[model samples]
Target chain A: GAWLGTAAAPHERPGARRGAEMKKLYGTDAAKIQAMEAALQLSFDRNCDRKQPKYWPVIPLRL
Target chain B: TSISASSKPGADPASLQTEQRARSMMRERFLRCLISMANKKIQFHMYEKVKVDATFGASDIDVLNFQVSDLQTPIGVQTEALIRCQDVISYSFDM
Candidate 1:
């Protein structure tokens, strides 16, 4: 009921939508997959924040 | 649904569950492998036969980019860098 025509619908939230998609894709093990992805993403974000790593080459190699 | 191309359009529910479980197991194992690679020396093979080594850090959830440290390039060693996954043809590291 709260979601009806609401601006902050569940689908509007990327994280919530991702979790829902994972559930549809992974079924009973969605939580486990989601946890792994979250941890991996967290480490990437933390490293980028702390290291301030720049992209090498400064240009796309493939395109 | 975003089911794989191989999945039949009107597949039964039980078979769909089986397929999803299989996919989850495969993805979980792949993620575990990526986790184990952290801090290890990884050699990335790129186009034009260019190769470089870096201490593995972490990859984005989408696997589009890899954040690494001490990247050994042709010119000099970069203290830290992010490699676009699209540029990489393959990568390997010791267990």
Candidate 2:
């Protein structure tokens, strides 16, 4: 009954939440840090897409 | 995230700003180091005493995965592979 009564907030955006967190963590340099992260992420995504790299060892090495 | 612990509750704005700036500087330096590793041969030391070498390609924003080329594993050489950061204990590259 408690689960049915509570509605999930649909207005919250994950990207916006991460931006706010970055601002809180980096203060004035949040934009710069965000930019660098964005660029690195883009490259990683592009390389993975083009190369289709599979995970080595085929299993968790630590766990 | 470690720096957040240093900022005590009810701390002054100036001190909080200083802490945040320090975190930013450290993170920026780390990111720059990753960027410099691109196209360089990196030696990764993993758990279970597994050591491998690969040409660094790119790393995810979260630093959770590293995309590399020509990964030399115990079995054989992998043309391209994605290495989980969790598996890697430490990685080194020449300047």
Candidate 3:
């Protein structure tokens, strides 16, 4: 079977579940990511289609 | 504004003061909760059930807080943390 798009195995720290999710979020629109982080989204998993690993959002949060 | 108890002939000033304070705190906490929920919903889009449960703790700064677990009908979450409102939610009240 094709492992493409599938995240790492369950035992894997960043397994397929996470890998698949990250793929969508690796690179995305900045405005949306800033919005998500502003709302206390401390964690950004692979499924995050907005930003990168740093879910805290280094950028200043705009009100 | 003239409150019922205030106008009452035998209203206890002490108790009324306490009630007023409590009401004020409750209003603050409730508004904070609403904003938090709205921000969470807007941000994650998946956090439609985000909630904020507040309690009057020993200190004004540290209020008891809770949230419904993720995806729970009433906003539920599993965690015991003393969350401060300013710590989260970049809220802007236009109205």
Candidate 4:
């Protein structure tokens, strides 16, 4: 039987697989931090009774 | 790590104070995160494609180790375990 292959098997490379895995596993640090902030919004401090109590706000950096 | 910025030589006092404020804020957020994770089932993603689940108990101030319960490892389930923070790349749990 005759078969055909793509021009370049990019996915076959180890580096490509690792790159794809990393992309799937973790997001950009900034985005991850944003998601963490969102999650924290829903969580209450163990010492607190309210849903979102008085928590210190993270100061924004100038640069 | 806790704080990355160190006041540079000849840096203005005002900027140094600002940097300290930022550091405290970040540390506070991280502490709050730890508190929220207490008693929650967390899934840890480690290096070499390893993943494990455990009930988070507590972590030291330095965050070098984590005290967990019912740690599900490849060998067997441990009643109580101390996981090295370095071994974990990331961990998460729903609120």
Candidate 5:
């Protein structure tokens, strides 16, 4: 797998894989996001859709 | 009292025909592919590239296809999907 990542800014879409329990999944500050993304070196947003239908997340920064 | 674990059997011919029919049905769905090699070759030579991308929604995906770019062949003219979309999710391929 060359790349596997979620959309950036999980809170923006809110319809992420975590469901309404998004807060419980990522803490209030996004530590899980950092860890998963760091481990994979890929973007991780709670978001599902990627690119097209309007390219987004800009560059998907790690920070 | 236990049944034997090792069992060997042959496929029934009627079942085999059913499997063949299934394959035939799928092939028929893509009838164009059933045409002569020359025909496929024509399409193959005509299109330089083919792209596939998915568009997911709140609960499911809406896979889409559209030509992003092409110089030698007709683009955005052909598209297919295994599942129908319930919402709008468009995508395009670029040359």
Candidate 6:
């Protein structure tokens, strides 16, 4: 079998190992993340979008 | 006119003012979230088990739609696209 070529194990790649660990951590936090979303999305309903009105009211601007 | 808490009837004026302040803060946080998402690779989960990856641009003020670039769809890669928020079940991205 061609299994003993490298000096180190497969997990020796730091970048790939860190990425895999992050994905696992994120999976466990899914429920907490959903709760956080509920808290943050309270004011973002459909009718909340707004922009400044273009009227005749004048406001001072500092230089 | 903005959607303030004052629209509700039978509510005390002081409490309505407090609620409007909280709502403004929550909205500001959400806007910050949107700003952080700019120019990132996002995975959008649509209906019917469809998932696509794209670079997120800006979303409309109402959040009704999101503008993306280099969207990798099933058919082909679109140079630019607008994804309706109603069609998206969820989206995720790595910081």
Highest DockQ: give the candidate number. Answer: 1
Candidate 3 on B1-95: residue-level lDDT in tens?
Answer: 76654322115545534543554455445545544443242122112233333221111212212122222223443222223333344322222
Across B56-95, the per-residue lDDT of candidate 1 in tens digits comes to: 9999877889999999999999999999988999999999
TM-score of each: 0.84, 0.85, 0.22, 0.55, 0.19, 0.54
Task: Note the DockQ of each predicted structure.
Answer: 0.47, 0.46, 0.01, 0.02, 0.02, 0.01
Per residue, candidate 6 scores C-alpha lDDT tens digits across B1-95 of 76643343124555545543554456457767886887899998876677889887667545666767678877777766667776778999998
lDDT score for residue B85 of model 4: 69
lDDT of 2 by residue, B1-95 (tens): 34434434124678668767887899899999999999999999999899999999999877779999999999999999999999999999899
Model 2 chain B is weakest, by summed lDDT over 10 consecutive residues, at B1-10
> What DockQ number belongs to candidate 6?
0.01
What is the two-chain DockQ of model 4?
Answer: 0.02
Error of 1 at B49 (Å): 1.6
Please give the lDDT score for candidate 3: 0.30
Question: Candidate 2 or 6, higher lDDT?
Answer: 2
Residue pairs that clash (backbone atoms under 3 angstroms), model 1: none
Q: How many residue pairs clash in each candidate?
A: 0, 0, 11, 0, 5, 0
Q: What's model 4's lDDT at B89? A: 83
- The CAPRI category of model 6 is incorrect
lDDT: worst 10-residue window of model 5 chain B:
B61-70
User: Which residue segments of model 1 deviate by more than 4 Å?
Assistant: A1-17, B1-10
TM-score for chain A as predicted in candidate 2? 0.71
The list of candidate 5 runs beyond 4 A from truth reads A1-63, B1-10, B33-95
For model 3 the local lDDT of residue A49 reads 26
Task: For candidate 3, give the lDDT of residue B2.
Answer: 62
Cα lDDT, model 3, residue A38: 36
Candidate 4 versus truth, CA RMSD in Å, comes to 20.5
The most accurate candidate by lDDT is: 1
Which pairs clash inside model 6? none
Stretch of 10 with least lDDT, candidate 1 chain A: A2-11
Error of 6 at A5 (Å): 72
